[model samples]
Target: MSQFAGLAVELEESGVKHEMITYSGAPHAFTVFGSDRYREDADKKSWMAFTGFLEEKTGVKAM
Candidate 1:
């Protein structure tokens, strides 16, 4: 497994609550808009996940 995947597994085993989202075929910095490595699908999905998590925790929806 990749390093981050291993870390996620460890966190689960240790009872740490967290979310892990991975984008297949997304290069590094895929979330950076307008960059050469930007991936629209991955970027949008990741942004949604991030905002959703924040809303879930703080009960404030992102604009």
Candidate 2:
């Protein structure tokens, strides 16, 4: 299963309101704003921040 799918399942099981938002046909490396920008460092940072935010908000570790 995809990471997104697993995360959605976990969040649902935790009774947290969550949605998987995706832009169909968009490249994996693309930014959320669709800027065609790819930055490995920034992506890692963003992912960490997002995960931290989710944990803080939901009191659940996504992983």
Candidate 3:
């Protein structure tokens, strides 16, 4: 999530338009387990933080 937050911040700082997508349910199911290796408690937190940062930075509601 921190990574994504950073990206969003970078994009905003650079004057670029960007959008972020977040998913519910088991992460593995959504990606066909593609994120198996990347899944972690910290990653989940990062994602949440990223979403929050995106909303605050872009003034866009997250779906």
* Per-model TM-score on C-alpha atoms: 0.79, 0.43, 0.40
Better structure of 1 and 2 per TM-score: 1
Report the candidate with higher TM-score, 2 versus 3: 2
lDDT of each model, Cα atoms only? 0.88, 0.71, 0.67
For candidate 2, the TM-score is 0.43
Model 1: per-residue Cα lDDT at residue 41: 93
Expressed as tens digits, the lDDT of each residue in 1-63 for candidate 2 is 398898998999999986566545445765555466665556666677789889999999978
Please list all clashing residue pairs in model 2, or write none if there are none.
none
Provide C-alpha RMSD values for all models, in order: 1.6, 8.8, 8.7
Error of 3 at 36 (Å): 7.2
For candidate 1, lDDT tens digit of each residue in 1-63? 399889998999999988777898898899787899999999898889889989998999999
Clashing pairs in 1: none
lDDT tens digits, residues 1-63, model 3? 688789989999999987766543335344233456454554666567778899998999776
Give me the displacement of residue 62 in model 2, in angstroms: 1.6
lDDT of candidate 3 at residue 63, scale 0 to 100? 69
- Which sections of candidate 3 miss by over 4 Å? 25-29, 33-63
What global local distance difference test value does model 2 have? 0.71
